[model samples]
Target: MIKIAAMGDNVVDCYLSKGTMFPGGNCLNVSVFIRRFGGVSAYIGAIGQDEAGSVIEKALHDENVDLARLRILKGATAYCVIGHRDADRVFVRADLGVSMFSPSSEDIAFLKDFAAVHIGQSSGLDDHVSAAAAQTLLSYDFSTRRDPEHRRTIAPLCFLASISGGDLSHDEALAIAAELRDCGARWVLVTRGSEGAILLGAEGLFEVAASPADLVDTLGAGDTFIARTLFGLIAGETPHALLSAAAVAAAETCRYFGAVGHGAPIKLSGVVPELQTISS
Candidate 1:
């Protein structure tokens, strides 16, 4: 079986307008999506003892994602307050809380058991990327980070590098993918929202148009694409076939309200004093 580990970052996306929250974050979403795609997946991260953390835990548990490495700290769980503007998500506020954490030497050792380990820009584990990559194939999500120096530093360590390029033109996105490829990433994928996605590797460039969807929310579409792409790659799928499958999976995510659909009522009063009074 294709086994993967998603290390770093987890959060509850609080939708203030709807008074609901959903478990999210790039790594977390990737883990869940990998499992949904029939891969053996594990999640490694820290959460707080708060309600949001419980929400995240339950969601992961329900999805059957391995959580043996999950940590429960005494603090608030990471969260981002969101609002909708005509089906588009708008971030209103956020706090990292206890989400940021580094893996122990033992944790790094554990990573070797998986086929690949996925980490993201928001993961706060940049310093350990080299160490982790040494243990297993590494998949890194740049997530709209365009800093040349940052890309150059990390791209070389990745087996597959993913970027969110929804705002960039086709030429711009392709250039970024090539840049990552030149930087030593075995493969590179750039997702361009409605414009679709592009993949580059030893085989050359492959492009696919976005699949149509009944638009609802776009929260986890990119993460879905990344997870599906990773799954397809591990399954030895062709570049064009994987990109097409990933685009379809991403579009399916767009039809939902949350990353993976386990939502609960959000109690703003329990979040933080300042958040309680914020208008939806």
Candidate 2:
């Protein structure tokens, strides 16, 4: 089985509608979808001891994902308030809790068994895991970096990268991806929401048009796309086939309510005995 370790932030995504919560955050979401696609996935990060943290813990367990690396702390759990406008979501704001969760050498050693490591936009954890993931394939989601310093920092670490093209045109996005490659990324994937995804790497540059679907909450579509793309690559599918598969999977995620909802969350009681002693 393909083993992948996802290290970084985990957030409790709270919807503004009725205060409904979901387990999210780029790396956590990726791990869920990776497991859904048959990969042996593990999530490595710090989750708070609050009620929201319990929700995240229960959700991960229900998804059948490995949670041996999760660290519990006393701080408030990180969360984002998602506002909805029809089928689309608007990011209201976020309180970044546990955004600074960086694993130590022991944690990195545990991740060495995985074929690849997926890094999230969790401040310093990207750099922290890059060294540990050196022997393994490392991929990161840069989100969108308009800052030159941030772009430079992203370079020379991860083998593959994913970023959102906010308002850049086709040509502009291509240029940006090329620049990212020059910086250090072996492959640069630019996601353009409904437009589709453009993948630029050593083999060649290719574009995958978006699959049409009934839109719902766009919470974890990008995470699903990344997970599917990685799955296809691990399965030895061609680039074109992988890209197409990823696009379709991402579109399928929009058909659901929030990320991979395998079933209802299993309510967890009491503090995590093993995790309670750990500090943030």
Best by lDDT: 1
lDDT of each: 0.92, 0.77
lDDT of 1 by residue, 95-124 (tens): 899999989998899899999999999999
RMSD of 1: 0.9
Which tens-of-lDDT digit does each residue in 17-126 have in candidate 2? Answer: 54356778888898899898888999888889877787788888987889998898878777766677887777776677765676778788887788888886654575
Models 1 onward score TM values of 0.98, 0.89
On TM-score, the leading prediction is 1
Task: List candidate 2 segments past 4 Å from native.
Answer: 262-280
TM-score of 1: 0.98
| Alpha-carbon RMSD of each model | 0.9, 5.4
Please estimate how well model 2 matches the true structure, expressed as its whole-model Cα lDDT: 0.77
Error of 2 at 129 (Å): 3.6
